[model samples]
Target chain A: MNIDSIKNGYVIDHITAGQAMNIYHFLNLDAMDCPIAIIKNASSKRMGKKDIIKIDIETDINLDILGFIDKDLTINVIKNGERIKKYNPELPATVKNIIKCKNPRCITSTEQELDHIFKLTDKKNNVYRCLYCEAKAGK
Target chain B: MRHLIDITDLSVEELDELLDLASDIAENPKKYQESCKHKKLASLFFEPSTRTRLSFEAAMFDLGGNVLTVSDANSSSASKGESVADTAKTVSCYADIIAMRHPKEGAPFVASKNASIPVINAGDGGHNHPTQTLTDLLTIKREKGRLDNLTVGFCGDLKFGRTVHSLIDALSRYTNIKFVLISPEELKLPSYVKKDVLAANNLEYVQTADLEEVIPQLDILYMTRVQRERFFNEEDYLRLKDSYILTPEKLKKAKEDLAILHPLPRVNEISVAIDEDPRACYFKQVLNGKFVRMALILTLLKEAGTL
Candidate 1:
C-alpha cells in the first residue's frame, strides 16, 4: 500500500485500533474538502495494531472533542512533507455543545436554545457528567 | 451576586452562621421582625409546589417583607414562551430576591446567572434544593444539639430524593458523621453521589435494604417519599412507593434519641401513629424551613446591598 505523505496537514496517530472512524466523525473529517486517508489496523511496534488518520489541509480541529474521544491519540503537525510537531491533547475541564445531555429531566432537554455542557467529574475514569442534571454522559 | 443553588454553595462556616441567625430569629422574633421591611420576594413556581413556595412566602412575611408570587407556569409569561433568563431578569426589577421552582433540573441555575438580584432554588426537579437542606440542618442541630459525631440513616427513595443528596452533601463537611443509607435495591442512592460527595470527602457510609436492623444506631433517620413525579413508569412507582413504610413497629427498635426527619407532603411512607412520637421532628423541620429561609433572605439581601 502506497499512501502519499501530506505536505502541510495533520497526522492523527496512535489511535486505538478500530477508533479512527470515531475520530474522523467527531472531528468532522467527512465535511473537509482536502485529501484524507484513514489507515485502520496499521502495524505498530508499541501497540499491537493502531489506527491513523492523515489530513491534507491546515485547519483548526477541536482538541476537546478529540481528547474526550481518546486522549492517547497523538496529533502530528506536518509541514513540507516533514513532521514539525507532535503533542497529546489534554482533557478539558468542561466542553460545550460537544454532546447533548441524554437525561430527560435536564433543563437542556426542554430549552432548545440552551447550550449543552458537560463537566469532567472523574479524570481517571474519563467520566463526564451533564452540567444541568449531573447525569453521566453516555458513550 | 450570591445565589443559593446547591447546598455545597455554602461552607461549614457560612452554614453555622446561617444556623446561628435562624436560631436567633426563633428565640427573639421581635428583633428581626422588620429586618427586611420594604423589601420584596418574588416566588416564581414553574411547577406546582405547596410547601416550598408557601414557606418562602411565609418567611418573607415574617420578616415584614412583601411577596410577589407567580404560582404556576401556565399563569405566567412562561406560557407565552418567555425563557427563564428573561423571566428572571424581569422579576429582578420587581423584587429584592427571587425564589424559583421548575420541573426541569438546573432551571434556577440559569435564573441565577441572568437575574440581577439574588436567586434561591426552591426546588428543581430531582436536583439540589439548598433551602430544604438548610431546614434539615437546623432541625438536626436543634434535635441533637450538634451536627457532627452522629450516625444518620437516609431511608426510602435516595435515588430521586434531592433532599437526601443535598443533606448528605451538606453533612459531609462536618466531622465524625457516618451515613447509613436504607433503600430498596432499585431505588438506591446514585453511585456518583456516593463517589463524589461521600468517598471524595472521605465520609463513611453503609448501604442496606433493612431499616429496622440499623435503627438503633442512628442519631438521625431521614425518611423520603418515593416521588411519583420522578418515575416514568407508573408500575415502577407503585412497586417502590411502599417499599419502606416507617410504622410504629419499625420505630420500636430505633434509638430513643433518634431524630426522625422527612421532607413532607407525605404519601404514607410514615404512618400517622408515629407522629405523636417524641422522635418525630418532621413538623419542626417544616417550621425550620421558614426560619432558615428568613435567615437566607436576610443574608442574600445584606450581601446584595438590598437590605
Candidate 2:
C-alpha cells in the first residue's frame, strides 16, 4: 500500500514470494542476529504479489541467486541515513561461491570436501554445468 | 573434482585407466583395502536402491573405508523443507565423499556444485547413471574379454530404458560394433538417440520388432524388463509380454560365448530358468560394480592427494 523506506539498512525488494525461503537458505541467514525482516505476500503492481527482506547491517548480497528468481529485484545499501549503493544484478559469468548446484549426481554433490562450482554456460537459457560431473542444467 | 557426475567428463584414456584399475582391484582385493583407510563415505540415497547402495557400502568396506548413510529421503532432512542444495552443503561437511541417488534429474550435479568434496551419482531419475555405465562396460569386458566389435542386442523396452540408452552410447565408441535393437514398435529407441548416437557415428544397427528373428545373431543379449506399465494400452502390453521373455529356449539360439546381461534386481524379464545358464553374467556384474567403484574412489582420492 505504501513505499516504506529504510533508515540505515539494506532492502532486497521485489523478490518472488515463494522463493523467499530458497533465498533464505541459499544465503544461510537463519542463525544471524542482524535484525532481518522478511516481508512476504507484499503488494506489487508488476508482480501482483511480492516479497522483500531488510537486513539492518552491511552485508554482501548474492545477486547471482537473486538473478535466478527475478532479475528485476533491487538491492539498496543504506549508509548513515540514506541509501548509498544499489545493485542491479547482472547474470553471473560463473556461479561461484553462490548457490549450491541441485543435481544430486554431480561430482560436487559427492565430494564432502570440495567446493561445488558451476560455469554459467548459456546466458539466455540460464543454464549451468557442474564442475565435476560436467552435467549441464536442463538435462 | 567433487563428483562423478557423468562418464562423458572422463576421457577414453581416463576411463580405460579406471577400468584397468578396477580389474586390478578385482584381481587383488588385499592391496586396495588399505587405500581409503580412516576415510569415511556417506551415501545419501534419496531413492530406494537396494543394489547400488549395498555395492557402494561393500566397495568402501573392502577398501578399508568407513561409511555414513541416509538411504531414504523420508528419513532425512529432505522430508522437512530443506532445499537440496543446503542439504548438499551440510552433508559435504560431514563425509569425505557423497553418493546420491535421487528421483530428480541432475540432483547429484547440484550436490557436487555445493560441496567442496567429491560427489558420486549413484543414479538419477531417468537422465544418466554413469556408474551403471561403468559397471556395464566392465561386465562387457570381463565376459566378452573386450568392449569392441560385437553384435549387442537390446531386448524389451528400449524407448524409456535409461540403461540401454547409456550402454548404447558408451559401447558405440568401440570399433566394428553392430546393434540388434529388439523391441516392439510401440517401444522403440528414442529418435534423438537413433539420430544422434547411433546413426551419427555411421555404426551398423538394425531395429526389429522380433526378438526371435535376431536372438541367434547377438554376442551380448542385454535384457531389460519389458514392464507391463510401459505400455500406453494394457492390451498392447499383454500382446507383447510373451515376446520379450528370455528363456533357455531363447538361449539355445545364442552363441556359446553369448553373455546374457541385465541391469538386475530382475522382475520377470528374464525367466528364472535362464538364471542357471552359464552365460548369465548379471550377478557377477553386481560384484564388478563394487570393483569399478573402488577404482573410482582410489582415482578421485589420488587426484585430491588424500589417498
Candidate 3:
C-alpha cells in the first residue's frame, strides 16, 4: 500500500492505535475537500503500533483536540516532499466543545446551545473535568 | 469579582475567613445586622429547593436586605424560553448579588459569566452546593473544634449525595483527614470522586458496607438521605433505602463526642430516636447554613463593592 507523500501538508503522527477514526471524526476531516490519508496500525519504533493522518492541505488544525486525544502525538509539516517542522501538540489548559459532559444533571445537558467545556484539572494524570458539572471527562 | 461556583473557588484562607465571619455573626448577630442594609439579593431558583432557597432569603433578610425571588422557572420568564445568561443579566440589573439554584449543573456558572454581580450557587443539580459545603465546614469546626486529624464517616447514598462529595473535596485539602465511607455497594462513592479527589490528593479513605463497624472510629458522622429521585429503578432504591439507618442501637459503638452531622430534610436514614442524642447536629447544621450564607453574602458584597 504505497500512499504518495504530500508536497505541502501536515502529517499527524503517533496517534494511539485504533484512534485514527476518532481523530478523523473530531477534526471533521470528512467535511474537507482536500485529500486525507489515515494509516491505521502502522509500524512505529517508539510506539508498538500507531495511526497517522496525512492531510494534503495546509489546513489550520486544532492542536488542542489532537493533544487531548493523544498527548504523545507529533505533527510534521511537509514542504516540497521534505519534513520542515516537527513538533508535539501541547495539552490545552481549557477545551471548549470538544467533549460533552456526561453527567445528566450538568447544565450543559439541559442547555444545548452551551459549549461543552472542560478544564485540565490534573496534568500528571491527564484528567479533564467538565467546567459546568465537575464530572470527569470520560475516555 | 468572583463567584462561588464550587467549594474550591474559595481558598483555604478565604474559607477560614468566611468561617470566622460566620462564627462572629453567630455570636453577635447585631453587629452585622445592617451589613447589607441597602442591598438586594436576587433569588433565581430555576428548580424546586425549599431549604437552600429559604436559607439564602433568610440570610439576606437578616442582613437587612430585600430579596427578589423567582421560585421556579415556570413562574419566571424562563417559561417563555429566556436563557440563563439573559435571566442573569436582567437579575444583576435589579440586585446587588444573586443566589441561583438551577436543576442544571453549570447553570449558576452561566449566570455568573453573564451577571455583573456575585453569583452564589444555592444548588446546581448534583454537581455542586458550595454553600452547603461551607455550612458543613463551619459545623465540623464548631463541633470537632478542628478540621484536621479527624476520622469522618460519611453514611448513606454517597454516590448521589452532592453534599457528601463537596464536603469530601473540602476536607481532602486539610491535614490528616481520613474518610470512612459507609454505604451499600449500589450507593458507593463514585469512582471519579474516589480517584480524583481522594487518590489524587493522597487522602486516606476506607470503603465499608457496615456503618456500625466504623462508628467508633469516627470523630464525625455525616448522614445523607438515600434519595429516591436519583434511582432509575424503584426496586433498587427500596432495597438500599434502609441500608444505614442510624438507630440508638447502632450508635452504641460510636464515640460519645461524635458530631453527627446531616445536610437535613432527612427521611429515615437517621432514626428520630437519635435526635435526642447530644451528638445530633443536623438541626444545628440548618442554623449554621443561615449563618454561613450571611457570611458569604457579606464577603461577596464587600468584594463586589456593593457594601
RMSD of each: 2.8, 9.0, 2.7
Docking class of 3: medium
How many times do residue backbones clash in model 3?
1
lDDT of each: 0.90, 0.82, 0.90
If both were scored by DockQ, which would come out higher, candidate 2 or candidate 3? 3
True contacts kept of each: 0.76, 0.10, 0.90
Q: Clashes in model 1: which pairs? A: none
Q: Write the per-residue lDDT of candidate 2 for residues B162-278, one digit (tens) a residue.
A: 899989998888889999999999889999789769988998999998887898889998889888878789999998988988888877877888898899868888888877889
**Model 3, which residues run further than 4 Å from truth?**
A16-18, A28-35, A38-50, A58-64, B227-243
Worst 10 residues of 1 chain A by lDDT: A58-67
Model 1 off-target regions past 4 Å? A30-33, A41-49, A58-64, B226-243
Candidates arranged by lDDT, highest first: 1, 3, 2
In candidate 2 the C-alpha lDDT for residue A12 amounts to 85
**lDDT at residue A31 of model 1 (Cα atoms):** 90
Q: Candidate 1 at B96: error in angstroms?
A: 1.5
For candidate 3, write residues B1-307 as lDDT tens digits. Answer: 7789889998898899999999999999999888899899999888888999999999999999999999968889989988898899998889999999988888999999999999998887767889999999999998888889999999988988888988999999999999999998878999988987999899999999988888999999999888788788999888877767889998999899999999988878889999999999999999999999999999999988887
Give lDDT tens digits, candidate 1, residues B189-211.
99978988999989999999888
Write model 2 residue lDDT over A1-139, tens digit each, in one string. 5545656778888888776776777667787777777888998999999888887766555456667545678888887768888886776666654556566755445445556567766677666766644466441
